[model samples]
Target: MIQAFYLPNVAQIKKRYENNVQTLLKYPFLFRKDFPDFDSLSVQYFPFDDNGYIPFYKNENRFGSYINVNDPVIDRYFFKNLDKPILASDVYSQYQLEYLNDNVRKSEWVGQENHIYLHYTNWCNFCNFLSCLNFKQLLPDKKIVFLFEEEISRYPIDFKKEFGIDYSQYQVKPIGIREVNRLIWHTQLAAHNGGDFFNEIFYDHPNLLVFKSVMFKNIKEIVKNLRRQWKQRGKLSSRLETELARLRHPTDKDFLVALFLNNACACCDNFRFKNSKLQPYSEQYSERKKRKKRSTQKRNDGISR
Candidate 1:
């Protein structure tokens, strides 16, 4: 059925989202985040989807993290192609999808296991809220991060190609805002206290960070991006790293990123992947937490009287 499903083409994407949203509404408990309006698709809009906090699940299964889908979004926008609509809004989703596709090469649009494709405006909120799923429920310690910025529109494709493949991972970018550097500094500070996920701010101001903070959050360029992450992790103000170093692994998931990120700037506090390798975060749990989880497992192990 998955393969038989026609990947939502330019003409079909709107219907898919509308149907999907309708389907989601039947089960409010499942997706607590706001369903993305067909209008919000093109570019990031502040506070709309800051990171996915609406809800529409039947029983209870919030949509997990967001990965930037590939580049057709950009193509559609250029052609003025749009996904269908629920009530005829601005078609933001179509525009955003096109914006992201235009931002990255064709190869990177496919999904990767762990990564959150953030958009600068409302889309960022959408992705941010998606983080709550305990997506690591199946794969423990999965690493992911919010990819954003509003300046990618400056360099465009030729500029990104020079940066290489990893650059493709960054989709969902913003167009431009002259005050980005200062804005990001504040954003990072606000998100820092929420939890471990937001603890690590990629102070990475890539040439592209100029895009929306959701899509183009990479370092200056590929080469510099890597260097900055490694060499500069410690150089950020001590206040930034101080609280981060103290994060206790989930006293209870109540404080988890999935639960509370949307309350503020949106967050991805506990990432599972690092440097292209997946890290098993489950291992970092305390003995008590492990025992608690094991006890729940035992209960689920199925031996009811």
Candidate 2:
């Protein structure tokens, strides 16, 4: 059996200890042989410097091979020096029965269908605002629960006052990466900016909606689209909504096992799993010359006319 150590980004470990701990517990099965007494393994925390890099663990350690769940650039450094450099997805094919069993208990958090999960970070505040506003207009009855990376105060605007929305209508809470996983597992619907994190974890979720920050060209266009969607479909059905609500809640052991197997077997984009070096683009000056010639000919013809 091949044994590998799981190395998450030290910054993430420091910021979200609880969530990282859960991931450490659940995701170790990605390896063939478990680290000796894996449950009893103690983690040591280190402080990160200005660039979010830990200077201490730059060299190879006693841990034979390793699987990393961090940015590709950061992983690349380890890959260059490490004995065996396997990406996180490389080991995702393995599943442990204990982890699947544990997921069933975790799924208990899945509850009523009335709550809508909204994921936003400081980077994409405008998209978050638009998503919340649109959802409120479309489904006034549904409660909006905003999940953030840090404290709600870090956001630039007060969502209620800025949008003229009531505070009673929504709730804001800061969540860790692991909590986001559990919330996605149980929530009725998740509206987010289509970040890589959401794409990876909630890959199979049915009721996930993504709004692009760059798509906000004009208010009129946004309103027109929102109204069009609302007119076409009045609202989600009670039964269908309830069904989506229940899908996240895995009560039965068989369902949990099946889901775990599906996740393990599912294919992800190969590019996401590896850090491909940037390649230089060949010049297309010939195509540009042809286009310029055509433009000149058209202008001359217009003048002659």
Q: lDDT of each structure?
A: 0.31, 0.29
Model 1 residue 229 CA deviation in Å: 32
lDDT of 1 by residue, 1-305 (tens): 12333222323434545554554345322223355566554322122143332232323433333333321343332322211101111223433433333333222322222222332434444442332222222112111122234432322222234434353354422111111112233254455566334323532212212112342254234324332342255432343233324555422221222112221211222322222121222344435455877898889877662
Model 1 residue 243 CA deviation (Å) reads 12
Write down the worst ten-residue block by lDDT for model 2.
85-94
Q: What is the lDDT of residue 39 in candidate 2?
A: 22
Question: Which parts of model 1 are misplaced by more than 4 Å?
Answer: 1-73, 76-283, 286-293, 302-305
Best by lDDT: 1
- Candidate 1 local Cα displacement, residue 233, angstroms: 25
lDDT of 2: 0.29
Worst 10 residues of 1 by lDDT: 81-90
